[model samples]
Target chain A: MPDVIQIKAFGMIAEAIGSDSLEIENPGTSLALKKQLEAQFPGLKSMKFSLAVDKKMIQEDTDISQGKEIALLPPFSGG
Target chain B: MDRFERQVILPGFGPEGQGKLKQSSVLVIGAGGLGCPVLLYLAAAGVGKIGVVDGDVVSLSNLNRQVLFGEKDLRKNKAETAVRYFQDKYSDIQWEIFPEFITVENAQELILGYDLVIDGSDNFPTRYLVNDACVLMEKPLVFGAIYQHEGQVSVFNHGPNSCNYRDLYPQMPSAKEIPNCSETGVLGVLPGIIGNLMALESIKVLSGFGKPLKNKVLFFNSLTSQTYEVEISANSDSKSSIPETWKDFEQMDYELACEGIKQLSWNEAMKLMGHDVAFVDVREPGELPPLECTGLMKVPFSTLSSQLDRFEDAEEVLFFCQSGIRSQKAAQQLQQVYPDKKIFSIRGGINALKS
Candidate 1:
């Protein structure tokens, strides 16, 4: 079984998801995982969030591993 | 035994922190509410070198929150008044006053010499410009902002773990969607709270103290007196591809970034209440003082994007939040998806609803 990746959303995104973290099987790539998450949570389509693998921001099409924490960050309005 | 004696006794910051602060240089943008507390605390904390950047002159209305200046200081440049005030109180610290607003052309060079940048700027363009420049220079930024009774504070670009402001807010809301502090009145202590937090974070970064909120956002709600902490992670979609042309940066006007959204003043929106215009309150479900409109609907800001289809039949839609910032962003998103639908933001949000 593939390791489950945990993703967290903050600020506006957190308020949208209505929860903090979303756990799912580690999809091969960040884009794939995003699509899967969006499919699961239809509300995610309207949100403009960036994917962060582990703690740092991943710009390239990177793969997600087991136990890694991913964050779906919305545009932070906080100063 | 001195007023700063307690702080001086802390580890790392004991003698070195004091010396670094005295020798360190900081450039603060804006001399308004946020800048006022930031400047005051930085000077009070004995930062050796301080620079004040702002072109606006002190005004009578600023007295409510801009505690650094008074009626007598009105008509004087904010930077000049701040310098004078700091000099009188802390003669030991060095001060530089820039009586001009930070522009894209000067933002980079002006921010280069400073060890840290504090963004008290109110507009989206200035904030983005500052963040981009700071990221390019690899300088840490202590950011603070206030809307109504709530405030946000964060530290960006301190170290390898640092995240730039863009990491949090990748896109800038259109100017038509957002309002300046002047447009939306801020609570007097809101900026003070956030500004002091900026100072605290800066000190932590400078002195290497307790875990700084590097890559994390701290939120304060004065209305409910509650605090929420959120961890910020880097985003993949950010335009890491820096443009090759200087004109590109200049032309990248944040005001025009998110288009297709219309803006309506409170009065203008009120006039359409009985018409086909639909009002959507995008605040949280439990957000206080539910918007009181005859034809208004509540769809918390977070859910508006996913629930866009709910208003399919509406000829026009109006978005609003506590202070209009979130609503403006919502309208921008709505415009992106529903090009045919006329989406508008209520300037000053619910605060203006009454007016």
Candidate 2:
């Protein structure tokens, strides 16, 4: 079994999903995990989120470890 | 006594939230109407450190809504006035003022040290920049915005429970599509009501007292005196999508994102106003203000994408909105789809046309 990654969202996206956190089985690569998340959260098809692994944004297809913290950050609205 | 009062009475606050407030550091962007109330209340509440950031000086028009200044403050920096006001009202609290507007270049550094961020800005670019910086810094942000009689408030990027602003608006709408207060006008008291809500949310977040609007959006309609709350959930697709660097932030140019198209002045658009040139309003039907122009077609911006086929015969197209921001975006989109046909936006929009 792959390790699980914890993710969270807020504001409009939260309103759409109706919850703040999701636990997904790490699928080895960020791309696979992204696909799994999209299937679970359909509202993100049109939205943009900065993907961060353990609070640091990752651009490349990095390997995911067990129990790593993942956050899907939506565009900010505050001034 | 109120629960808030009980927390105030504790050792640091002495029966008021003053002490907790005194220890708290808050950065307020924009000294306009919304900033006015946020500044006044937070200062009065005895917040310890307050930073006021704004680039513009006081204008006669702002006097109507910005309570922080008066006739004497005209042409004077807004951040300076706010600092002076807080200093005079509560000498005990430490206040700092940044007279320059917060920009993408300095936002992250300036916002990193603050405990909380209060957004009172009027534009989308600044708002998005602030949200991204706060999320990067792991700082709590109290968000508020007012359009006519409606206002919205939310706590963003506080912690595991926090949400970012982009979750609410995935993309920026062209500036021309939306009428800013400068063109549309607003009630003087609207910002006060909204600013107070921002203060309330900030206080809630700082003291960890009541249920903060974290991950939730609360909308207030002053016209009908109704309040609505919407639940916002975490977007799973957003996972693994955090912007990796500052360069990524620059990639999303909100000015271009919201208003992607290019535009020309009214005079420039008039040159092409013949049979070969098509004019599309890109505004809602009722939103079309009275304007005297020939060879113009009215199509609200929302439906412009779908109605593009109607103008297939025209060699060129011109788009206009109240301010020209939306029209530019429309033109940009049209240019992408029809690379051969020229699409132009009327700068300053219909308001300019009428002028």
Candidate 3:
């Protein structure tokens, strides 16, 4: 396995990230994965968001598995 | 057996549920898009008391989603107009009008006595404040947010297993990066779908008839007519983010939390009529409610790139539109191209200045 991860974005996060979903190489942990994403898309460094693995939101460093579905969600202000 | 007889005769909801609804009080935090439909349904359902909190006046551009007010109601305070319009519709229900924004100074006072708080505010600062205030007050909150064709609705701080907004995302994005509805157009019907869901959730919570959205968020994509639910869990860090006391909450800076682009008042914009400032109208030439005073070169926001050379001779540039929202976006675009030049958007646009 290449240890690849599937990514999905919603709302403003999708707006900034262009495509709604993509594949990225895993960085071992959820925290490390976010660092890799910010490096690729610098806009994410300034945004407040959370990462969801297999539909569950993760707050701390967690092991990343191959074929895990990840989602980047931002706080939406629209009423 | 009157106007409410249909719902009163429904399966699970009877006179007792009606009684609970009649006894319940709800405070809706904003009077715009989401607040309008939420207030309408609650009023028609005979919610005992409904309070509305908003400091904005109805501008022309708000007519799309804010169905409560009309042309005659324009320029009137939103909180007052929505309350008064609904007050006469229902005799048994009481409508409370708070013509003010829900600030830290007033959040607790406005939310404490109410049975539940429904957040319909349109900015990050207000959304965060509402979430934190609900958590601190120990009150149930029905949260809803819409972007373009998608909407998210959740019931937070209500049940034992419920999750607050902070639990979902602990940090708030800088306000400068986010766009309001004016800049990023929203489908007019989307808010109705979300706001009505909020009202339904509120009623379910108050009457104890059905399960409200506890510890879960419903994401609806109107474009495809599909809804996806994300099961959320409480985060320990989210709890720590809440201010421990009202004193700390009072010291919080909401403006700095949700800062937008640079803004100038209409009068300040007009003061540059003869100066080195280049007047740029970001709105299309045919857009309604044209500027009362002339001399502004109409460079539609959609075609701003090719027209950048027009302002080469100016020391400063002022952007304005029908309601001032698009102008701020134009200023941001120009700022990127002309980083060294001064740029500002008139705060309320020509609509605010016309009268």
lDDT per residue for candidate 2 within B236-304, as digits (tens), equals: 444334455777764554444455554565666767778788888887777645554676688888888
Q: Which has the better DockQ: candidate 1, or candidate 2?
A: 1
Alpha carbon lDDT at B275, candidate 2: 79
Please provide, for model 3 over B1-355, each residue's C-alpha lDDT reduced to its tens digit, 9 standing for 90 to 100: 5777988998899998998998999999998899999999999998999999887789778999899999998888899999888867778888788986687788889998899999998877788889999888889999998878778899999957668999987776644566767668887799999999999999999999998988878888788787767778889888888898999998876544454355665666667667688888788878766764566688998899888888888879888887666776678778778888888787657665644
What number of backbone clashes does candidate 1 have, counting pairs of residues 3 or more apart or in separate chains?
2
lDDT of model 3 at position B333:
75
What TM-score fits each model? 0.63, 0.60, 0.79
Backbone clashes in model 3, listed as residue pairs: none
Global lDDT of model 3: 0.83
Question: What TM-score should be assigned to candidate 1?
Answer: 0.63
Candidate 1 lDDT, B84-155, residue by residue in tens? 887787768888888876766677678878999999977665677788777767889998876555677889
Q: Score the docking of each candidate (DockQ).
A: 0.20, 0.07, 0.59
Chain A TM-scores, one per candidate? Answer: 0.81, 0.79, 0.91
Worst 10 residues of 2 chain A by lDDT: A70-79
